[model samples]
Target: MELSDIRKEIDTIDEQLLPLFMKRMDCAKKVAEVKKRDGTPVFNPVREQEILDRISAKAGEYGGAARIVYNTIMSESRALQHSLLGAGKDLRQRISAAPKAPRRTTNVACLGGAGSYSHDVLQALYPQAEPSFFSRFSDIFRCVEQRQADLAVIPVENSSAGSVSEVYGLLMQYCFSIIAAKTLGVHHCLASRTGRIADIRCVRSKDIALMQCSQRLATLQLPLSEISSTSAAAELAEKDVGIAAVCSESAAQQHGLKILEPDIQNADNNATRFVVISKEMCIPDDAQKISLCFNVAHTTGSLNSVLSRFAAAGMNLTKIESRPIEGKDFEYDFYLDFTGNVHDPKVLELLCSLEDELPRFHFLGNYCEMK
Candidate 1:
């Protein structure tokens, strides 16, 4: 057959597909009505799998593509069902009713003392708030958990060294709401009282900090110890001439140590992203970022289905990371950061769908992010 004839036939098939698609969608709405009347959930994984299985068996060589098409169509069917039944209405109301954050919070917890990078974040956002510095990341979480502080400002990721895994673990453990985030430039320096690289025998800093400066630390041939924070390392380095701390220049100055070597981190543009966590959810009018953690079904295409919802909504996913679910052996929980204000109708609907359908779904927070 000629190419033009094939195109004409394809056009004819496309014309036929539209009416069939409409009929299927109409039937899907009727199913929703039945489900609503029966008080049944919108998502029926078993039924969906059965349909996929039967279709795949008949489609032969195009099974995978056929499965994808049905997945999308069925996903849209579920979406319509969810809408008709007003799924996530309660969640939407609660999110909409969240109180706006105060103009100034009174108490704040951070992971370092004096001149650490976390302190810089604190100074930028909550300088007026009473600052309680903790030695460990867990301590910061505990401080908030115990209501000793109103909020905890802690590092979540570094530009070069990657995520602060311990902090993420703590976040999962505590399940606090992230209210805001900030990113600050990092400039790691080898600081010591001796002010001499030759005199350095040991190096100490936060694990993330040491990792950021691993290349520089290798050339010095010094033993490294993981300390609570970069500032604490500087404090330790100040009292011992043989120890050097990989910390910010400001931290060294605060602890009466001199900067022996400056800008030692691997990346010139190294930065750390910090999150301000609170016990309550607060969505400001101008909020533009959302953070959530949850697990999808341990089945094929489950994660893809969840991601597809976001894509269909025209939402942008900025970051995603997985950590082992504490007791679930090899299974994991995913942490996702996406760009959307809860006030947007489509965004709210998508979030509600996720809250309703996903397992262990936690709407961490919808908040404004700062650079």
Candidate 2:
């Protein structure tokens, strides 16, 4: 066919498709009416699979594409049915009962002391809040859980170091909600008791700090050791002339260590994202970021189906991290963050649908993330 003729044929087929899609939805409404009367469930996996099988058999070369299209049509049909039946009542109720704004108070807890990155974030976001520093991540979580603090500001990820797995684990264990988040620019320095870079024989810092400056450390050819925090490593370096620490300039200053190298991280854009978590759930009106944790259904294509729904809703998913579920040999739980407003009907419906469908899921929180 000529190019113009092919374009004309495509337009004609699209014109024919509109009415067929509308009629199909009208039929779906009637089907919903019958199901409501019979007290039948909305989703019917067996019937959907049978229809898919039948359609694929005759589709020939277009078999895979045909299945995808039909699958979407059926998904939309089930969604309509769910709406007609007023599904997701529990989650809706929870949202209605939750506070729209987080409580502003002075009891804020975070990991590390005066010059730690977490401390920096706490100062930025909750300057007026009283700070309680802990040596361990769990200790901070415990403080919040026991109501010793109103909130916790902690680093969840670093741009150069990747996700902080220990923090993720503690977030799940504590079951706290992230009411707000902050991302801060980071610049690392190599500090030691002596201000000479040539005197450094070994380095010590947090694992994340080590990784962030891995490239610079590789050239030094020094043995490395892991400390609990960058600030703590600086403290140790202040006491030993041979050992070095990769930490913030402020940390080295506070610990009385001399800076041997400044800005040692691999990337200039190195930054850390911190979350202000609370025991209470809050959905602020300005919430543009939503965090969710979920375990996918075990059936084949289940994860694809979940992600497809997000794509269909036009949601911009920004982050996804999978962690092994404890006590389960190979099962994983996924932590996802996406830009969305729960007040939007489509967004709310997507969350509700997933809550009802996923094997395990938690709406961690919805809040405005600040830079």
- TM-score of every model versus the real structure: 0.95, 0.92
Question: What lDDT does each candidate get?
Answer: 0.88, 0.87
How large is the C-alpha RMSD of every model relative to the true structure? Answer: 1.7, 2.1
Give the C-alpha miss distance for residue 318 in model 2, angstroms: 1.2
* Model 2: residues with Cα > 4 Å off, grouped in runs: 327-330
Model 2 Cα displacement at 13 (Å)?
2.1
lDDT by residue (tens digit), candidate 1, 1-371: 99999999999999999999899999999999998789888899999999999998899999988988888888877877777777787788878778889434798989879998888898899888888988888788888888899898999998898898898888877888899999999999999997988888899999999999999889888799999899999989989999999999889999999888899999899999999999877888899999988898888888888888888889999999999987787788999999999888888778787788888787889888899
To one decimal, what is the Cα RMSD in angstroms of model 1 from the true structure?
1.7
Best by lDDT: 1
Q: What 10-residue stretch in candidate 2 is worst by lDDT?
A: 297-306
After TM-score superposition, what is the CA distance of residue 34 in candidate 2 from its true location, in Å?
A: 3.6
- Reference-based lDDT, residue 219, model 2: 92
lDDT of 2 by residue, 1-371 (tens): 89999999999999999999999999989998998899898877788888888988889999888888888888777777777777678888887788987665678998778788888888888789889988799998998889999999989999887999998988776668889999999999999988887787789998898999999999998899998888888888988888899989999999988898899999999999999889998888989999988998565456767777888899999999888988888788889999998898988898887776577888888899999
